[model samples]
Target chain A: MRNLFNYIAKYHFFFLFVFLQVISIMLVIQNHHYHRSLFINSSNFLAGNLYDMRNNVVQYFALKSINEQLAQENQALMEKFPESFMKTDQQIFEFRDTLHQKQFRYINAKIINNSVRNRNNYLTINKGSMHGVQPDMGVITTEGVIGIVQNVSRNFSTVMSFLHSETQISAKIKKNNHLGTITWQGYDYQKATMLYIPPHLELARGDTIITSGFSHIFPEGIPIGTIDEFEVKRGDYFFTIEVDLFIDFNQIEYVNIVKNVFRDELTELEQSQ
Target chain B: MEFTALKYFGRFIVIIFIQIMILNHIYFGGYITPYIYPLFILMMPFSIKGWVLLVVAFFSGLTMDMFSNTPGMHSSATVLIAFLRPAVINFISTKKEFETSTEPSFSVMGKTGVFFYVLILIFVHHFSMFLLETFRLDEIGAVFMRSLFSTIASVVVIMLAFLFSGRTKKVRI
Candidate 1:
C-alpha cells in the first residue's frame, strides 16, 4: 500500500490529466446527440449577446471590405455577356438564379462573438430566443448555410458554423433526388465534402447540391454548393465528392436564423413511435 | 497580495476584451482567430502554486468561454495547459536560471527558449482544444490540418503579445 501510494504521488499530474481527459470525452459523448444538452450549448442568448458585442467592433470594419468585394462581384456578375447560341449556359444561368434565390431566408444578425480558427468553429449572434432563434435552427448568409443554432439565451444565440467537424447536413443532387450527407472536414472553411453519394447516380463538375428537406434543420432546396470535383470509392458503391460552398463563410456578415414554426409538432409526431 | 490580485484580474478582463473584440473580428479566411489572451497565463508569476495556476487559468478561459458561448471548451483547454505548465517550466528553466521575479517573457527566456516554450504549450493547448471540438476521428486529417494552421497563427499572435508586453511597471501593492 505504501509503495502504491508513493507511485501515485510521484505521477499524480499524469493521472489527473488522464482523468480530466476522460471527463471531457464523457461530456462530449453526452452532448453528441442534439436537443438533449441544451443547458451548456453556445445558444445561451445572454452570453451570445455579450460575445457578439466583443466581436461587433472588429466585424464592423470587416463588413466594409466585404461590402466592397460584394459590390465588385455583383458588378461582374451583372456584366456577363449574353451568349446567344448555347443551351448549357442558358440552363446554367436559370438554374443559378433559382438555386441562389429559392429555399433560404436571410436573417441579418451581427456576430457578437465568433471563432473560425478553432477546430470547432462557432458564431454568436445578437439575435436570440426572443428574436425567434431557437436551438437546431439553421443559420445562413447570402452564400450558404453557416451553421445551426446549438444553444439559445433570451437575447443571444450561438451558431455552430459549417466549419465545425461536427456539422453534417443532408443534401442531394439538384438534378436528381440522389442524397448524401454534407460535412465539414475541418481543414478549409470554404470547402466541404458530400459523403455516401451513390456511384450509380450521374454526377458532373459544377452540378448543384441542395438541402433535401428531410431534416427540419433546413428547408428543402437550399443551395449548398456546386460539385467542385468527385472521386469514386475504390471498393465502395458511393462517390466522395468535393463541394465548393456557395457562401464564402469567412466573409459572411449578416445571417438568417431559420425557426421552423412546426418543429416541435414534427418532432413530437416523429417521437410518438 | 490583495492589490496584486486585483491588478491581475484587471489585466485578465482587458486581454479577453481585446481577444473577443478586436482580434475575433479580423477573420482572414477564418484560418486565424488571434488567441494572444492565453499569454496572460504564460506571463503569470512562476512562483505561484500549481493549483492556483490551474484555477486562474480555468477562470480566465471560463470568462472567455462565457463571452464566446463555448461552454467548458476554453476552460478545459486552459486547465490542461495550466496543469502541464509547471512540468514544462521545470524542464526548460531551472529555478536558479530564472533570475527575474517577473513571469516568463522573451527577456527572461531569451527569444529561442521562449519560442520553444510557448510552442510546446500552445501545441498542447490547441491539440486538446481541437480534439475536444471535433470529438471525432472521421475527419482526422482535416482536423489535424486546422490544428496545425491555427496553432501557427495562435503562436504568432501569442508571441507578439508577450514580446510587446515588456516588463510590468512596478505598481505599489
Candidate 2:
C-alpha cells in the first residue's frame, strides 16, 4: 500500500493526463452515440451570438452574391404567381374554399457558421426555439436540401449538415421511385453517395434524387441532388452511385427551417403502436 | 507576478477569441484546420501545477469545442499536447529553466526550437484528433493526410501569430 501510494504520488501528472483524456474520449463517444450534448454544442447563446457578430462583418463581402441568389429565388417565386401562367388550364380544375391546410411552414435563418471538413459537421443558424426551429425539422435552401436540425437553444440552432458521414437521409430516384439512402463518404462536400439501390434498375447520369418522406423528417419531393456517377460493386446487390448535391455548402448563407405541423401527430401515433 | 498573470489571462482571452471567431470559420477544402489555441497552452508559466495545467487545458479546449460543436475533439487534443509540453520542453530546451516570466514563444524559444517543438506537437495533436474523430483503424491514410496538411497550416499560422503578438512592452496588471 505504501509503495502504491508512492507510485501514485510520483506519477500523479501521468494519471491526471490519462484521467482527462479518458473523460474527453467519453464525451466524444457520448456525443457520437446519442448527440445529447446540447449545452456543449454551438447552439448555445454564447457561441451562437459570436457567430452572429462574425457574420455581421463577413456578410458585407458576400452581399453581392447573396443579392444574386435572392433575386434568382425571387424570380422563381414570381413565376409561381397566378398571373404568370395562362388561365386555359385553370378552368379544368375545380377549387373549393377552406379545403387546403398548411402542411409545411418555413422559418428563415442565416447560416452564421458552417463547416464541411469535420466527419460530423454542423451548421449554426441564427434562428432557434424562440423562432420556431427545433430538432428533426428539415432545413432547406432555394437550390435544394441543406440538412436537419440537430439541436436548438432559445435563440440559435445547429444543423447536422448533409456533408457529415453519419448523416443518412431517406432519398429515392425521382424517375422510378426506387428508394435509396443518401450519405456522405467524408470526402467531397458537393458529392454524396446513394446506396442500397438495386442493380437491375436502369440508372442514368443526371438522374434526380429527392427526399422520399419515408423518415418524415423532411417533406416529400424536395430535390436533393442528381446522379453524377455510378458503378456496380463486386459481389454486391446494389449500385454505388455518386450524386452531385444542389446546395453548395461553402457558398450557403441563408436557409429555411421547415416546420411540419403533423410531425408530432405522426410520431405520437407511431410511438404508441 | 500579478502583472504576468494578467498578461497571460489577456492572451488566453485573445487567443480563444481569435480561434472561436475567425479561425474556426476558415475552412480550406475540408483538409486543413489551423488550430492555434495550443499555443496558449504551450506558453503557460512553468510554475503552474500539473493538475491545474491539465484543468486549464481542458477548460480552454471545452470552450473551443463549444464554439465549434466538436464535443471533445479539441479538448482532448489540447490536453494531450499540454500533458507532453513539460517533457518536451525539458528534453529540447538548451536552458535548464525557461527564465522567469518569459513567454514560451517564437522570440523567446528561438526560431529553430519553436519550429521543432511546434511541428511535433501540432502533428501529434492533429493526428490524435483525426484518429479520435474516425475512431477506426481503416482510415489511417485519411488520418495521416489530414494531420500532415493541418499541422503544416497550423504551424505557419501559429508562428505568424507569435511573431506579431504585440511583444512591444510589458503591461502592468
Candidate 3:
C-alpha cells in the first residue's frame, strides 16, 4: 500500500496534466455537436456578467461613431419608407387576392466583444435569452448580414461571424437568379468565395449578391455583398467568384437580431416529413 | 517557505493576467500577437520535478485559453513544450555544468545557449498550435507560415523578458 502511494505521488503532476488535457479535449469534441453543447458552452451566467463589465468600457469609446451610423441609417430608412409603401401598394393592387404579406421585425443589440484577428472570429453580444436571443437566429447590421447566433445564455450570446471559415451563407446574384454558396477561404477578411457557380453564369464585376433566404433563419432578400471578381477555369464546371462584404465588421457595434415568429412550427413540420 | 511559495504564486497570477487581458488584445492587424506566458515556464527552477513542470505549463496555458476562447489548443501546445524542455536543457547543459536549481535563462545558459533553447521551445509550441488549429494537411503551407510568424513574435517577447530579469545565484536542490 505504501509503495502504491509512493508510485502515485511520484507521477501525480503528470497524471494531473493528462487528466486536465483529457477533460479539455472532451469539452472540445462535445462542442462539435449541437445537442451536447449544454455545459461546454461559453454562454454561462458568469461569463455573461464578466463580458457585461468589459463591454461597458468598450461601449464608451464606440458610442460616438455608433450614434452617427444609427442617425444615417435612420435617415435612409425614412427616405426609403415612402417608396417601399408605394411598391407594396402596387403589388397589392396587382395581386390583391393571392399575395401574402410577410412582416419583418428587428431587435437592437450591442456587440460587447468581437475578434476579427482570428481566421474564425466569433462576436459576443450583450443580448441573450432574457432579451429573446436564441441560437441560429440571424444577426445583421444596417449594412448587411453579420452572422448567426451560435450560443446564448440569459444575458449574453455569441455570434459566429461571417469571417469564420465554417460559415456558409446562401447568396444569389442580384441581376440574375444564379445562386451559390458563399464561404471564407481563410485568406483576406475582405474577400470571400462563392462555390458551385455554374461556369456559364454571366456575372459582372460589382454585381450585387443578396441572401437567398433558403434557410428559415434569415428572411429572403437580405443584402449580402457585391461580387468583387470572377473567373472560370478551362474545362471546370464552375465559376470561382470573389465577394466584398457590405459591412465593415471591425467597426460594427450595434446590430439587429432577427427572429422568425413561425420558425418553431415550420421546423417541426419539416422534421416530421 | 510559505513566503517564497506565496511570492511565486503572486507572480504567476500577475503574469497570467497581463498575458491574457492585455497582450492578447495587441494583435497587429491579425499578423502578430506575441505570446510571452512561456516565460513563466522558462523561469521555473531547474531542479523542479519533471511532472511539476508539465502541470505548471498546463495551468499556465489553460489560463490563456480561457480568455482566448480556444478550448485546448494552448494547453496542449504548452504541455508539449514543457515535456520537451527538460530534454532540451539536458542536451544544452550538462548536469555538472548546471550544478544548481537555477531556472533556464540567458544568464545561466549564456547568450548563445539560451537563444537556441528558447528557439526550440517556441518553435515546438507554435508548430503544434498551428497544426491543431488547421486540423488538416491540405493547408499545411499556410499553417507553417502562420507558425513561423507566431514563433518569431513569441521569441522576441521571450528575449525581452530575459533581458529585464537580472541573473540570480544557482539554487542547488
For each candidate, what's the DockQ? 0.33, 0.71, 0.31
Where in model 1 is the C-alpha error above 4 Å?
A1-31, A36-47, A59-110, A115-117, A141-143, B25-34, B95-102, B105-115, B137-160, B165-173
lDDT of 2 by residue, A1-273 (tens): 999999999999999999999989988988787456857998887888878888899899999998998899889989988778788844535463434776778899889998877777889999888987878898987677888898889999999888776788899999999999988888778889999999999999999999998777787888988999999989888999999998888899988888888899988999999
Q: Which ten residues in a row have the lowest lDDT in candidate 3 chain A?
A: A90-99
The candidate with the higher lDDT, 1 or 3, is 3
CA shift of B152, model 1, Å: 4.6
Candidate 2 chain B minimal-lDDT segment of 10 residues: B164-173
TM-score of each: 0.77, 0.93, 0.85
What is candidate 3's lDDT per residue for B1-173, written digit by digit as tens?
68856877887887876775567667754756778887788778788777877887887776666555566767788888888887898888764567565766666788888888998998888887767655568888988888788788888888877766653333431
Ignoring the other chain, what TM-score does chain B have in each prediction?
A: 0.88, 0.87, 0.89
Whole-structure CA lDDT of model 1? 0.73
Task: Give one digit per residue, the lDDT tens place, for model 3 in A61-162.
Answer: 878897998799888888866556655434534434323644455678888777776766777788888888888899987567888898887788888888
Tens digit of lDDT per residue, candidate 1, span B15-116?
887886667556555565556777788878877766677767767766666655455667778888888887888788764556535788776777877888
lDDT by residue (tens digit), candidate 1, A83-106 = 443556335444367454354444
Candidates ranked by TM-score: 2, 3, 1
Shift of residue B84 alpha carbon in model 2, Å: 0.8
Cα lDDT for residue B23, candidate 2:
81
The digit string of per-residue lDDT tens for model 2 on B107-155 reads 5678888788888888888999888887778988988998899888999
Flag clash pairs in model 2.
none
